[model samples]
Target chain A: SQELEQSPQSLIVQEGKNLTINCTSSKTLYGLYWYKQKYGEGLIFLMMLQKGGEEKSHEKITAKLDEKKQQSSLHITASQPSHAGIYLCGAGRGGGADGLTFGKGTHLIIQP
Target chain B: GAGVSQSPSNKVTEKGKDVELRCDPISGHTALYWYRQSLGQGLEFLIYFQGNSAPDKSGLPSDRFSAERTGGSVSTLTIQRTQQEDSAVYLCASSLWAQGEQYFGPGTRLTVT
Candidate 1:
């Protein structure tokens, strides 16, 4: 079974400060996806990275996949209260047909 | 275009009762997936359906849990003799094909007392 280990299970940061969350996969990641979730709500897609050493950014959120494709990182620059939520990194094993293995998630709390 | 949708946003049932949750995928989407999310936990893949291929049920926890997709569009997950451990948010997602981004539904919050 594939596993994704996320770092800093929970984080609290002051508004305007930057934060980074990492997800390390036990297997080579065929595809890496980032999502955000508010309490009791469905996850909102953030970004997806496939190629090794590839990086993608949307608004203040940026995600990167290393050359090894075994790890991915999500970074938030100049975070705001709206950025506070649970961030999840999902790793696809092979193709879109395969189920994604998800990390436990990083709980981000942004203080105003 | 509308996103995936699930019915009965919230459900509360007693232990030993059977519960059924429904999911309606976006029109034209050929793949649908069901997942379970425990309180403060990651997603647990329950089942998946892609076009006409045999459903990948490897993620189903046990025989008590089963799911079926009708005409490759809507899906229903049935839990027989539900236990307290079955309490979780059931999420549904759909994608245009097997290897692409998936849109998700609000999810059905099932609480077994």
Candidate 2:
């Protein structure tokens, strides 16, 4: 089973709308990375959160990690067409692992 | 190179044949990773190599899959006795250190018949 679980597998919203995506983990998240992927391209790193109750923002996007370290949420304000892509959340196994555990992902589409 | 480069941008192979995929990471990077994305599915970890130490192969799906780093710079992923289920987009990423953020490549699309 996936260690990281993402909610709302797919979402469609109109341009300029506000949206939020959630990621939950069975184990505490040592590192949380949010990436956006344009169709057929490599992942474009958005932000990384390490400490519990951490928050980071990039342009119109903001992400927050809960104090328990088991969940995180990404919020997008005044969305744009360029923001349409697959959003992925990945969690570390608290270090000493080969790689990060990635969630299935949330596919978001912004309509004009 | 400026970013990780993967070759044979696309590959089409037959079942039971062996296939090799190559990756060249950004210069001076010490950590490398291999992942596979299967037909709209999330990326799956395959192997990880850090510095000159032995690679961590725990994520390999089966014995049919193996990877090697020649000089802590370039790496190759080989799949033997390929099955149709092995088709996917193979991605490579490199980080400056063992626990740093990673930069990914464009990926190689593999199609097995």
Q: What interface RMSD does candidate 2 have? A: 1.2
| Best DockQ among the predictions, by candidate number | 1
Per model, kept true contacts as a fraction are 0.56, 0.56
How many residue pairs clash in each candidate at the backbone level? 2, 0
Off by over 4 Å in 2: none
DockQ of each: 0.70, 0.69
Cα deviation at B106, candidate 2, in Å, is: 1.0
**Clashing residue pairs, candidate 1?**
A96-B98, A96-B99
DockQ of candidate 1, scored on C-alphas against the true complex (2 decimals): 0.70
Q: Which ten residues in a row have the lowest lDDT in candidate 1 chain B?
A: B39-48
Superposing all C-alpha atoms, what RMSD in Å does each candidate have to the true structure?
Answer: 1.5, 1.5
Q: Show what share of the native A-B interface contacts model 2 retains.
A: 0.56
**Where does candidate 1 chain A have its weakest 10-residue lDDT segment?**
A91-100
Please give each candidate's TM-score.
0.96, 0.95
